[model samples]
Target: MPLENVHGDPIFTKINKVKKQYEYLTEDIETDVAIVGGGVTGAILGYYFSKANIHAVILEKERIAHGSTSITTSLLQYELDSNARELEEYTTLDNVITSYKLGLKALDEIEQFIKEYGNKCKYEKKDTLLYTSKEYEVKEMKEEYEIRKNAGIDVKYISEENNPFSLDLKAGVYGVNAGAQLDPYEYTHQLLDVSCNMGLKVYENTEVMEIAYGKDEVEIITSFGYKVKAKKVIIATGYNTQRFTKRNFGMKTVTYNIATKPVKSFDGWFNKILIRDNCDPYNYFRTTDDNRIIAGGEDVDFYTNIENEKLAKEKYSILLNRIKNMFPNIKDIEVDYEYCGGFISSQDNLGYIGEDPNHKNLWFCLGYGANGILFAILGGMMLSKLYKNEIDENLKLFKVDRFDK
Candidate 1:
């Protein structure tokens, strides 16, 4: 499951191979914002802060986005936790709805950035289709459709032939304004490139060993024997911040992913996000721009005596067989990648964002199960407002102390 003290991802070594070298944090330095992790959250923070002249500096323990962001299967759809509708039970109804709506807005904002900024990464916007093959599965989709509409989201049902997947679809949920797929690496690539050009300083191999929050400025000790001073700090360190935060956010949960090699005969592959209903042990799949298909899901808690590597190979074999049954035209496509990791989850599947409860100038952006990119966007937008003193009234639900007893 989740282990904070250890090196998390096995694929990190492969990703480090093709990464572009960036500037390093050699000695003590200062900035307006000291974002301690250079994943999507940190990069997006720099992206947004650069807009209003609040230049932020990123201090990553490793290379940028080499953590959880790289291992992600990178499906950008609005489909959230099953309990999204129950958000009103714990927090204000309007803020709950706003939080959900913000996800959609964040995707749109990213799309706009891609369009305006010439899409430095491999970003392709396509129809995000959710479908089911079971005859009795149509009702749940209809229910979700109504719930999404009620939550101020633009989602509805579409006919059989109109959906994006060529699979046997009995029903569908279509988010006309959502569903985006991008190369996780390329996405990070472009974001960091643009953010740096706009004055966001970044340093690799620099870990924030300790954070000393002060009323005037924040001081952080780096693993590289450097101390940083900044007006504010964003803890986007993923599971790495577990030992540093007041709240113990990391727990056990495992998710697996596998991708198929490019298919030549399957030329008419539908260009949309696909997710099956009741396929228990859920799965999510989407087509890549280069015509390969990335499908995964088979999330389970890690258990002992189960050979992790051998079991992973077996699960991927099962996945391939299932995909072939649905799309029979494809013939023996080789598997390109196999990845599995735990979601650095939260108690309510709602991220802990905004300022630290105890520290005035220290802020954090964390995720539950979903909302990696979505939460990053929300944090960027809210941080923008915070910089301008125009804070949203709906942000308190994501407070760090929501679970205090």
Candidate 2:
């Protein structure tokens, strides 16, 4: 597939200027670990490995944080895009509980990093609210609310008066110990910057063209005609994994996001709650600590003519209209930034993290399911353990071979 698409505004322009220090595979160099893709997941993996005093090198096809990670609206909340009730059917009881709890653990890791590293990014522990306008769905959501509560997940349901939108909430689910978000680009850059300072190496515009695995080391060939060797290779590329490996574990879907101009004096319907509508293809909204309303969706895809800009123009119009309808006062504001990208999600919505069982020393941390941030953090911890030949019990649910059938 060709690189670069006509989606997403230029949000990560800084990474483009970071300069590539290590160039080409003229003479093979060895490292304890090689992490591919500089998105959030790969960056986190690099940071964790460097902390272990292991020599880790990260190779990116393009600039750091310039992929789907930057395109995300940065909803770091634990309220999953996957319906909790729906998940119980596809996965085992143990897996479901582990999956639900993992979000908070990831949150804790991020909070600790910010504290230890100093108040760097816009990290804030926030509350996420999923609500429906329709009364019937509200009734159904109450059942889901109970499912989480019964599992000791600390969730609650919102009655009509409790919601900010005048449109009565039929149902609402709340998760408290769930999340934190900063500017995706800034957050990613900080991790990478600090990681580099700690002796971890990051190379930009250095895409891995091919991989040939060996008994002890893996040979990575890049498009720019260079090769590097690493004891363990971590495939940190998201959505692009299908292009390079077995495609059984993940599938791709398109999603959209929009960042409106900073609002001056707007009265929002809700106070610091992320809201999700029960509409067909769901719509979710959150507020930045600075007061700008950032919103996006569980995107819906359609036929597109690459030459025509009709779809983009129409999508922007639709998004703006929805924001106006929900918060009547925010109509005149400018939609200065917006983004759209393809997200590679798993069937059960949990990311694939750990060493490839068949190929020793070949590890991957593919972001799947609902929470990419949560999965990315989870991926780092799991990979560090797997690198030391420690089996992470949670990894069984994400076995790439299990879906071979």
Instruction: List TM-score per model, in order.
Output: 0.87, 0.90
User: Which digits, one per residue and each the tens of the lDDT, describe model 1 over residues 225-295?
Assistant: 78899988888876567547757764445566667777775633554454544465567777666666777
> Candidate 1 has what TM-score?
0.87
**What total of clashing residue pairs does each candidate reach?**
0, 6
**Collision pairs in model 1:** none
What tens-digit string does per-residue lDDT give for candidate 2 at 264-375? Answer: 7566665566667767567777777666767676454422432235565666667777777877755556676766666655667777876676787777787775588788
Q: Global lDDT of each model?
A: 0.70, 0.72
RMSD of each: 3.4, 2.9
